[model samples]
Target: MRQGIVRRVAEMALRIEPNRTAVLDWILHTPLPSLGMQTTFELACNGEGERVIALLNDLLLQPGDTVPRLPQSAPPALH
Candidate 1:
């Protein structure tokens, strides 16, 4: 179930970012505005992994633009 969630999020993000590595990086590195500027990792850390999946589902229902992306102001993903 955990892998399923990660894969689902990756697939959804692929629509906006084609590169798998970059998408995963964004997932772990980017802070979502809808979740109080918290990265998905942070959300999971707070024991809200399921909630993040639910939020992603809700966001998926809306237009593509509603989906979150890595902020330009954020530093590049570390090596």
Candidate 2:
């Protein structure tokens, strides 16, 4: 089963890259040097989903990088 964090990372990547197929391909096949040459997909499946998310977040925060603002909404009403 895919983790919520993994899904969230893909959503964020789409906002940044705007190419779903390329982003998915990178997540599944690109070996990240920062991750010991492991693909993000493998990390996500190997119980390192949060790490993959963190790596993506770090990439967005890099100098001159355009990090998309996450959509904000008011908290749901309490019953």
lDDT of 1 by residue, 1-79 (tens): 3546666666766765688888778778887766788877677666666766776566557665565543333556899
TM-score per model over all chains = 0.56, 0.70
Q: Each candidate's lDDT (Cα)? A: 0.67, 0.70
Spell out the clash pairs found in candidate 2: none
List runs of model 1 lying over 4 Å from the truth: 1-8, 63-79
Model 1 residue 17 distance off true place after TM-score fit, in angstroms:
3.8
lDDT of 1 at 77: 81
* lDDT score, candidate 2: 0.70
Mind giving the per-residue lDDT tens digits that candidate 2 earns over 1-79?
3658668878877766787887888788777666777777788888877776776676677786566532222455899
